[model samples]
Target: MKILSIVGFGGQGKTTLAKAVYGHLKPRFECQAFVPVGQNPDIKKVFGDILIALDEQTYTRPKLLGLDENQLMGKLNEFVKEKRCLIVIDDIWDKKTWKLVRCALQESNCGSRLVITTRIYEVAAYADEAYKIQPLSHDNSEKLLYARIDDGEGKYFDSLSAETCERILKKCGGVPLAIKGAFLAEELPEEVGLLTQLVCLRAGHWDYSWIDELPEEVGLLTQLVCLRADDYAIRVPAGFIGKLTSLQELRISCRGKDAIIMQFVEELGLLKELRVLKITRICRSESIESALLESLGHLHNIQELQIGNYSLSKYRVSEAGSLSYCRHLRLLHLDRLVFSALPAWINSSLAPNLSYLDVQVVVVKDQDMETLAKLPELSCLILHLTGTKLVSVKLLAEGVGYFRKLRFLKILGSLIRFDVRGSECNSSRVPSNNTIMPGLESLEFGVHVRSLKDEKLQLGFDKMLGFQNLGTSSLQRVKAEVNCGGASTWDVEEAEAALEHAAAVHPKHPTLLTNRVESQYMISRYQEV
Candidate 1:
């Protein structure tokens, strides 16, 4: 007369531990219920909500709206088959809806107790006693982060700083809904400048907690149009971002000091109606990258610009066209800024509505992939290639048909060498009648095996001709990582048997995620050949 299943994953609380064991055994049940069954469940409204929670004055709501699902599971198995029931159910997602709600629960030996909550481990292995729910111990996650920042009144958790409560419990890693949304309150209550018509404020915790300063009454939030304080050890005082000149979205992460991030990059040229600018941990200096390229040449209504860490290789192509007045630039993320080329204002007449491009480069030519495949609304490309000398870039299967709206291609590097020129091969290694990125769907790459007794740094995966010229039929997913640091073990079994024989001869047979790693061991491999 006990079912019990709790399982985890998904904020790890499992419906708050099955509502604390159904409120400590629902006063020794005589018919109790608590139902949720989400992820699209409406099994006749869950058997008419368990027959109106087992007898609401004889199943109310017009007696179960003219009963359906097998007459509301035959009046919920004849009223829990003679009483003493305590059902739960809550969030069970599939096992054919838990065998259609376990055929209306009939096994009542009068001490009946069901209780279920899941994230799916084969529906908690059909519960007889499954319970998996772990996560909350580092002394119960610092007593639930000081009882949620003092209601247990330890005076704001005794004024923080045990390195900000171990960086807010190592960034709320034990996840009680991320420590109840990490409200690291140590400051910012100068009566928050009476919320002067706050248009949106969003503080801290995007990745970690840090709010050491920002209260110059948050520049009296002059109708802030969206100011996300994405914590890089916060601290913004001096002219708090030019009084948020009606900011149209500015995510921050300035690491501080360097004259307060060069006076927050000269007050970001008074945010001329900035259309989403994200600045992260910046300050690699050269006078804060020439005052952030002179405040990105006055953000001409910049549309989604992200500039992180620094290093635009001594900018010159007329100072890297200071984002050539971002003509409504659509999403550009330049994180580990490394360009040595590929800048010249990222063409198509200065970013004609560029659609998502992340960059980092030391080399990538063939006119930097034909100036990023002539940009007509380029769709998602993340290319990194920091170079220390092993270059080879070819990729010209009709220049991937000028990526007419490319679909998400990532390529990080450890001394590049892509090569996919006019594919035509076949000695039985299949793949390649040449097509590449034809509406590509998700392809990530990163290799670097370094020294498998260098026959020009032996790359395998059947000599990756840029993944056998990806004859895309909208490829669905292919990730590779490799890096067998100082190789061997037959070069990691010849790079995992040439990535499981190139995902068993790909042609949109996608889903191939390999990892490889080495310097002792690491292997991950997911195939779907």
Candidate 2:
């Protein structure tokens, strides 16, 4: 029996140890059980709750056997079978509860490990081994502090202003919670106020929870309004992120001015552990130098990659060799791009793993459309494009229906033109009857249409007006828009009618459709309201 117990005081890392141990050992065990006994306990009730964590499917009826101490021992003995199992009783206080349960589970085999964490040393001694987990090392503590700091708008604190770092470290005393709360306080004067409050607190009396600190910073959420920035060069000092090898999600929003922040954009490649990386607006030209998609290949575990406004500029599809690197990506959000249709290199339909894709690009070609259309696992798509050059909607008419799990779709602009003999929308390019998007909830599109030389119908809008797919889609919201070619169509009569039509089709909901020229229609989506 490889039994280990972790013991520590009230705020020490007891729960973290159990979680880490389980994370380490679960794949090895045929069956694993994790039980958390809090500071106060009803031993009987905690044990009864054990069934929920165990991965047992056969037992449909979960019976809570309220056995006496002796009967409980028998029940535990009966509970564990030949399979190598794990039983963790956390925060145990008394010897009576331990002796009975310990004796009962003792019949299990050598590979079976038992882990328990409690503050009381006697309870810890009952186990075969123990570990004392202390607070953060100076470096580990500071890394967390610097990562979340919003250095004053103009100034970047790489080393956190020499004196400030020292003062914070001295007062916080290596206690992680205090360190976080202290640095997060408003001004130097407020820090002094917090310190005064701290000195008044009796030993072991301060509430360590961050939730307790919410009221002080709650107003910041509403007061914050961001002005556009080309890029931001925030200081990500070594101590803040040096040891973050397992780091997955990274969101560095640049609410700064119109300047290049290569330090922020380029350093991403170095963090081998990065998965979900989100950065605000960067000029399209910034990416030509960026080995972005390539650097992210190291993060094979990435789920989401988000970029803000004007990020995806005109790169040929061939330049998008980076998309190939993200093998496991599920969600891609391109917040606000200047144009439509993603660059050509991104035209790989082979990303079978993608699920949710949202882009604000305005330029997309037929091939890019076809490649994205074929993604089988793609469930939701929100593309707010400004321009599209596809000659025929058949590419969509053909491909979108094949997606079995597709639920939400929003496309903004498209061009219409196709030849009859496989030259325009090739004979083989048509979607089969079953290929229509069936599970759609929200669809918004605009296409350029040449009803004649004198008029251009936003073809995507026209298709949505007539196209109806039943049994295949359970659409809850549909916003179809058409470009009337110019400003003459932007009248009150047109807006109200379109809005009224939207209200009637989705009558239960508010207005869903709009008709306008390209500029107003595309820009409207980006407006927050």
Candidate 3:
């Protein structure tokens, strides 16, 4: 993988440029991983955020890698061997953070790339490709600023006297972020003051590096960001993500990730809009977490809370505060964790909406499941179990039918059932043996043990049937899957033909099925084959 850095002074749009590159490059890596690196970590929350971003909702640190950075990198190395990935390092502050992450990044393929943004030019020099962020010209700067507020190039541009426009652009310094910062800071009343004035002050003063209090429209640009509806549900704007009242879903990994968070959160004021927060590693004393959560008492609507790179040591474990206030929460992915025991500060009622929860190193006491499953939204759950003790998946599945919503479950590195036993599975009334799920549109289950190629093929078919037999409301089975990759159409077609034949054999399964292997995609299927 090649390291590339986008470097320039603050407000130069390094992040914006990096994001554009990431948007263009992410598809190249099937197992792509992206994180904004930050300082510090707690033992318990290390892997949750990475897992979440990888779409591995059930990710938990393996027992072998508990708090050992090398061991962790070793696992990432294995993933690199299996598939290509892209790791984005955003707003990197120092060299040590680079060192710690660089080891894991080394696992990608030759063409895999690293894209980083930093204020320091030295950091850019370390990268294979460096891009410097530059400011807009005097004319383009005015064009860009005015482009933001008014609808278009009509009277808004014509009415703007050249002299006034120049002065406004000068105040904004022709930097994109600052222009965005000011334009986004637009609240009608506050904008009234700026537009009517002969000389407008930049909303965030570059001289003092401070954001001035503005009217509501301009104010929304601070903590309350304007985000699309879908984004608010899954990924919110960088500014809005920090301001959520209850961090039901948050994973902030970098050092300043938290401070950047508080700045926006104070601005947003927990106004019922936020839902998920993905945090990086946060390092306040053990007493801070509970206190921090307390401030979030007003957010009762959050459904999923993710703490990126959650460590065991940095926060207080109390039964009080925001953690307990989330009455609607269903999922929690706590990464980089290292707590010996689960704290009592959490309660089932707090996560009444919780369906999926991934945490680091918890011994899944019977008590934990008992409280966890009772949640109204409880359904799918994954526990990495970062320990040696074995626990039966069936035994775990047996209790949660009241959470009939609870169906999908995963226990990573657990000795309970290395292989799913028919007897054990059939024994559960919850359809554990059925190997199928009802009301599920898509089913993606993976088993990583070494299996013969033939066995792997057979198992794949068997698993598909298992899914259909469980009887979804309207049975949904593997259908029309386009496997895109490789260097030739013939190779892709050959593979697709084989898959289509397999689907054809399953007459009892869902009918509609087609397979098209695509070349010019990211990675070829045969790489692993």
Candidate 4:
């Protein structure tokens, strides 16, 4: 089979180019199918679409849904084996999906053709001839933008000034999709309300100065399975969320008082189906009432919870600190909370299903580490240790094992940054028989070079290399970010070289990313795919 692939970023016209090619080639082939395989695709639906495109007589109903992927592919292969088919798979996201789809498109030895369109480079590399979609030229982009807005002839275009047209074209960013969406004539009605039987609804904080609150009509959408609202200026209408009994996910980021906010948090107990919930920027002076805390415990179906920056200074931190009630919680993130130590309820009985835990704590107690090691299902841990002095503890110290299933570790904030020049800690701190996190596949750590004036900061490359000697030979990738005040080229190259040497002996050829940036945290660095 002959294959042609088009690859580029979103809005770069990969789909448009595929459509154009399909239009030109469909007439020449005996059978053709153009299928859109989005980010999350069902292979059965894709096979059905291919069958319909080829005008094949096949039963596509609820009964067919029970067929496994292999069964579906087998039926599809039989239909297109002999025909000179032209198949286009659009917007493929990953190789695993492509491999599954490719197995069904067997080589007929009858001059069939395949075309793939994707944003990922590795997927495009599978093609015999791959073309990278380039950004539109200045002249072509202007022509396209004018064509979308112009009234039939050039009369409307002649009325506009050169300066205004130039300003509009500049915002298009050399992308045809952006240029096409630039100008529109109609404006929405002032008094607007969404009315639907939708299973999901997302409302933005539209013009906080003008729109203070959501329309009362939002209460009508009781069938909502997921709701996302980011409104801070006004309180959500009382008893609003209590109606969405079917809601599986709820995400809200806004500001309100203790009574108003806790009242809503209390209402969450009514959502028996809730699996994921996130509440951010909730300001409350009084501690959460025991009754309200008990309300959160009723959400036994909850698997994911995120509580960020909830200032509860007056409340006893330990009263609501333990999450033993959330037996099914799989992912939890607690950010900027004042808790002296790890809560007592973090055992396997409290959150046995826990897979990911992200916490930003004031201090990292030794016993806290010991407690974390006991979680059987835990696979990823992200810790943001706050105190400057207490942050420099060695993670690879002997006998610190509890992370049997842990695959990824991300240490952020002050804990990652170290004042190497002034610290009394020496290289001896690196455990000679260090044996922690033996199963880790990825590690992202940062260093504070914020005060490295005159480049006096010795980029700790050798010390990093010493980490490779730790008991965990499974560590395959390491990402190190240096806050190099204003990173010079010299600093970046030196740090990268050190990481390369450290992983040189690794059997898996571990990857090392050294991000040298001026900010407090390292900015993300780009790598060739």
Candidate of highest lDDT: 1
lDDT of 3 by residue, 1-529 (tens): 7788888888888877877888888877775566665444322243334544654744554543345566566665566556666767777777766666666657665466677888877667878888888888877876677765454435445554555555557766768766654432221233333232111123332433423233333223423232221111121224544333322233333334445445444443354655655544443444334334554565556666665544445332323434446666656766554344454534565455566766554465655544554555545555555443334332244433333454555445432321222333212233433333333333222222121122334233223222223323433454433444333444345444544454444323544454443434624455545
Please give the TM-score that candidate 2 achieves against the real structure.
0.47
Q: Across residues 301-370, which tens digit of lDDT does each residue of candidate 2 receive? A: 6677776645444433234445556657777875543433464433334455778887656456556666
- Residues 1-529 of candidate 4: C-alpha lDDT, one tens digit per residue: 7788899988789999999999999999998889999875657788767767766555555646678778878877776677889999999998888887778886567788999999999989988899999988889988976675455666556555565566556755687765663221111112112223345545544333223444555566676777666444334656667777888998877545666567677787899999998876653543444444566677889999886654544233443543457788989886555454566677677878788998656567655665676688788899876532224333433354556677898876553322122321224444434435557799787654333323343546445333454224687788876665544445455656656766665445677777765643333243211
lDDT by residue (365-435, candidate 1, tens digit) is 76678678768878788887763334555555453456666788888774344455532232243234444
Each model's lDDT = 0.70, 0.51, 0.48, 0.65
Candidate 2: stretches off by over 4 Å = 1-246, 254-260, 284-294, 297-299, 309-318, 335-350, 360-367, 386-391, 395-401, 415-433, 447-464, 470-472, 481-512, 515-529
Clashes per candidate, residues 3 or more apart or on different chains: 0, 29, 58, 0
RMSD to native for every prediction? 21.7, 15.3, 22.3, 13.0
Higher-ranked by lDDT: 3 or 4: 4
Which stretches in model 4 have alpha-carbon errors above 4 Å? Answer: 1-92, 100-196, 205-211, 231-234, 286-294, 310-316, 319-322, 389-402, 413-439, 446-466, 469-529
What order do candidates take by TM-score, descending?
4, 2, 3, 1
The count of backbone overlaps in candidate 1 is 0
TM-score attained by model 4: 0.52
TM-score against native, each model: 0.30, 0.47, 0.40, 0.52
